[model samples]
Target: MKPRSVRTSVTLAGGVAAVAVALAGCGDTKAGDTTSGSSKVTASPEAPGETGGSGNPTGKATPDTVPGHGKTGQTGGTAARCTAGELRAGWQRQPWSKDGHVFATLILTNRSGRPCTLAAGWATFGKGSSGRYQELRTTRAAMPGAGTTITLKPGTSAFEGVKYDATQGCPTIGGFGVKVHAGWNDVPGGSGPVVLCPDSFTAGTIQPTMNGVNFHS
Candidate 1:
């Protein structure tokens, strides 16, 4: 009976050892699977040109490159050309005389309540008397460079220079005036009983700057 008991005990111990070995193998396989999953997660990379989850470029928005875009006030956008009815005409004779010639500035003021644009273009001179108008021969000189469109706010003014040889004794004419053609508007600009040399009557192109006018020569 004692020998039988000893054999039984040995069999039981062997069975327990086999069970422990099986558990150890299972633990090692689970650990290896966990490690492989962690490596795959860490190694993944984002694709090129990806802007996070938003999908938009990561920078400031660009401004409009079109002409007259996002402007404000009188210069905000395309304005209507000034007309004779909306403008008040005036003149200022310059103090200094040069080379027997008289210089004067033809002034055009905006009388309308809104803003308007004026093109720098040809100006015509004429005599306004006896309820009749006669166009004077005007010599047009090219501007130093290209002239830009001028915008005038309400109650503002633009100017053009007038020059004539006073020494020639051509005529001391009353009701001398100028008609400036800008865009589709032909507006009268000037107040005169000005003495004009009709033969040498010359007008400069309308400009926003003095450089465009032949003030000196």
Candidate 2:
């Protein structure tokens, strides 16, 4: 009987050991599965063409579309037109005379401190005497080409031509002057007395470049 009991105890102890080993194996398998799930949750997504991150597929930046933003051409800002009050006038008479006509160069100088634009157009010729202004009529002549929009910096100048015809018995006029009309401003200009032939006066458009008084004809 003692021997039978000893065999039974050995068998029972062996069975208990086997069960413990099986439990340990199961616990290790469960721990491994938990570690693998944690790694998947913390992992970052892979980028395009990269090992782990996402970015622009083509890798090119966007371009600008705003006008005058990055290209040359007309800028959005325009120069301000010159005012008559900001101009100073002067004249240079040519030495030569032809066909009973005297020629003189008209100069319109900017007196303001800012830059301004001068449009191509006609100017007024007149005399200021006895506290009254008398405007002279400009003889009809062929228009001198198209006038250009000229930009003048501060202290800059523009030029024009004036023709006085003495062939038609011009009245003896003295104290001649020229007036520059820029936009809404009409500024008078002259130096000393301007001896002009009456009823035969003509003026030319303001030119961008200096061509003397003969450029009009």
Model 2: per-residue Cα lDDT over 100-156, one tens digit each: 555544555666887766653444445543223355545422224333455666676
Q: Itemize residue pairs with steric clashes in candidate 1.
A: none
**CA shift at 198, candidate 2, in angstroms?**
3.3
Among the numbered candidates, top TM-score falls to 1
Q: Rate the local accuracy (lDDT) of all candidates.
A: 0.37, 0.36
Q: Where does candidate 2 stray beyond 4 Å?
A: 1-77, 98-100, 140-144, 167-169, 180-195, 212-217
TM-scores for every predicted model: 0.52, 0.51
Task: lDDT for model 2, please.
Answer: 0.36
Clashes of each: 0, 3
User: Residue-wise lDDT of candidate 1 within 68-119, one digit each (tens)?
Assistant: 1111113223677665555554343444444456544455556688887665
